[model samples]
Target: MTIKSLSLKRKKTAPHGLSEPTDLSAYRRIVVLTEGHTNPQKAKTAIGLLRFRGGDVVALLDSQTTHQSAAVALAHDVDVPIVTSLADVSQPDALFVGISPAGGRLPPAMQGAIYQAAQQGLDVVSGLHDFLVDDPALVDIASRTGARLIDVRRNGFRETAKHASFREGCLRVLTVGHDCSVGKMFAALEVERELLRRGADAKFLATGQTGIMIAGNGVPIDCVVSDFINGAVENWTLANQQHDYLLIEGQGSVTHPAYSAVTVGLLHGCAPDGLIFCYEAGRTTTKGLDHVPLKPLTDLRNLYEALAQARNECEVIGVAINGRRLGPDEAAQEQQRVSAELGLPACDVYRDGPGVLANAVVALREQVVD
Candidate 1:
C-alpha cells in the first residue's frame, strides 16, 4: 500500500487514544491555530490530538501551508483542511494555540489569529507558558465578546493549599523516562487502556499538554511553581482515590539537567507503588545535550526505585522502550536484552501492546497481597 494509504489504515487501527471518547465534547468544531509552524513536531498539541480525534478538528490555521491537507503538512493523515486565516474557516466553537515553541513564549505572528478568533466570539485554548489572558488586547476582546480564554498551563496557581500525605489504597503506576519524548505518556495511557479492557477500574492522570487535551482535565506540572509541583501531583492523585489503579503520566527524566526538578517532584508527590521506566532504543545520549550520555537502564531503574522508596516503598516493575526509530528485528532484540538485564517485563507499549506491562503490574499487586 502507498504511504498515505498505510497512514490512513493506521489511523483507523492505531491504539493512540482514538478508541476512547474524549472529554472535549463541548468543542465539537475546533480550529487549530499553528500559523508559521505547521509541522507535527512543532504543532504536536494540535496534530497529535487531531490525528487521534479528527472529528473535532474543523481546520488547521497555518498561513505557511494554506490550502494544504493537514496530512501533508503534519506527516499524519488527519484529512483536515489548512486555512490561512480565520475568515476561511466556518465558525468554530474554539481556537486552540497548537504550537508549543521552545521557551514556551507565544510567537508574535500568532497574535493576529488570537485577536481575530476572540473578536469572532470563539473560545481560546492556549497551552503556552505565556497566558493569553495576560495580554490586554486579547483580554479586552474576550471580555467584550463573552469569549472564554482557557489557559491549560495555569492549573496550580489558584490553590494555596498544600498536598495531602500520600495514601495507599489503590495501586499507582507512574511512567518514568530516561529522556524527554521517550513515550512515557504513551506507555502510561496504554497500560491504563489495557487494565480497563480487562475490567479493572483505572484512570490515566495527565501531567502535560497532550495528556490534558486527551483527558480534558489535568494539572500541567511543568508550568506550576517549583514549590507547588509536588502538591499539584499529590492533589490529582488524591482526587482519584477511588480507582483500583491510577496510571500517572510522568514528566522529564531525573537525569535530564534541565527538567530534573519536575521529575523529582512527581516521584515524591504521587509516591507511586510501581514505575514503568521508559527509554528510547538506540538513543545513546540525552536529546539536545550530546555530552550527557544515557546511564544504563539498570542504573536508571535503581535511581527511580531508590527515590520512590525513600518516600514510600516503590518498585520498577517494567521497562517501556520507544522503538519507533528502530527496525522490527532490532527493536525486538533490544526489548529482549533489556528484559534480561533489568529482570523486568520490557516491551514497546505502542508496538507490542501494553499487555506485558499490564501483566507485570497485576503480578506485582498479587505479590503485595501474598
Candidate 2:
C-alpha cells in the first residue's frame, strides 16, 4: 500500500466525555492521520508516512479489524480522539485522511464544509482506493473541495509479510473467561509473557484490549480467532506445515451470559487439544456477595466436566487466585486450596516461582501429545 491509500486523516467521532479542547489540541500536534483498521503492511505504510514527514501520527479511530476493525490493530499505540464530527477537529497544519474499504468520499454537506475549509487554507490529503465505482455526486463534491486523493492498497499485504514471522514452535496459549473481570485480559498477557520467558512460544488470540468498554460485553470470543478457526482444517491438511499446540481461555460462570460457552462451542468445532480455566477466587467486584451461594470449585468443576464431555481427547488445566496482593504464605495457601478443590495437581503461578506457569505448560504438553 502506498502512503496515499490509508484514510488516516478523515474526521470522525471521538468517544463521549473526551471533548475538552486541550485533548483536541493534543491530537492536532500530530500531522498524519490513518483511518480505520488496516493489516500490518498497510499499517506500516501509515507509520512510514508519518516518519517521512517528520511529524507525529494520530490514528483516527478504532474499528474494521476482527473485533473493532483493522484500524485498532494497526494503530495500536497512537493517540486517537473518538470524534463525532469535523467541528471537533482542530485545524492541523496538514491532514491525511485514510479511506475505509468502501472508500471515504465525503457527502455533499461534508464536501461543502471541506471546500470552505480548503478555501481558508487547510492542506487536506486523502488515500482512497480505485474500487469506488459509484457516487458521482460525492466525487464531484471532492473535486470541488480540492482534496488530494492517493491510492495505497496494492501489495500492502506482501509488504506486511516482511515484518511477519512464525514463532519457533511456542505452546499457543488462549485466555477465556468472564466478561466482567476488569484486569483479566492482562492476566492473559501475563500468561503469554510467563510462557515466553520460559522459552515457550505463545500466540495470544484475544477478543480485544484489556478495558471492558473496548472489549465490550457479549463480544464473541470466537471473533478473535474466526479466520484461524475457518482455515484450521486446510492448514492442517498442509502436511509440511509445522504443528503448534493451542491453549483456549474462557471466563465468567460457565452459565453466565457473557461467559465463553459460545466461543468454546466454536473451538469444539475446530477441536483443540487442551483448555485452561482462569477464575477469580476472591470476592467479586459486584455487590450482594454475602447473600449469593458461592461454591467456587463446584461451579468450576461442573463447567469443566461439561467442556471435557464434548471434546475429543483434551486435558483441562485449572487456575484460580484473588487479584489482591498476597503474602508468600497466603499465596501458597491459595495454591494448595485450588489444587485440592479442583482434584488435580496445581501450582501457584506466583509461589512456585515465576517459572511454574511454564513448567505446568510443559507438563500438560507431555500428557497431551508427547
Full-model lDDT for every candidate: 0.79, 0.39
> How would you encode candidate 2's per-residue C-alpha lDDT over 60-131 as one tens digit per residue?
432223433223555444424434334455644444443222223432323443343344344443334331
Error of 2 at 95 (Å): 15
Residue-level lDDT for 232 in candidate 2? 30
Task: Give candidate 1's error at residue 237 in angstroms.
Answer: 0.7
Model 2 stretches with alpha carbons more than 4 Å out: 1-179, 182-184, 209-243, 249-251, 258-263, 284-295, 325-329, 344-354
Q: Which stretches of candidate 1 lie over 4 Å from their true place?
A: 1-25, 156-167
Clashing pairs in 1: none
Any idea what lDDT model 1 has?
0.79
Evaluated at residue 89, the lDDT of candidate 2 is: 51
lDDT of 1 by residue, 1-370 (tens): 1111221112221211112222343566788898988886688787656854578788999887754788888877568888988889765777888876656899998999999988986777788898876787777787687666777776534343364554455788899989988888888888988999999888899888777876677768899888888877887788887887899999889988999999999888887889999999889998778999988877888889889998877899999989978999999898989899988889988679999999998887777533
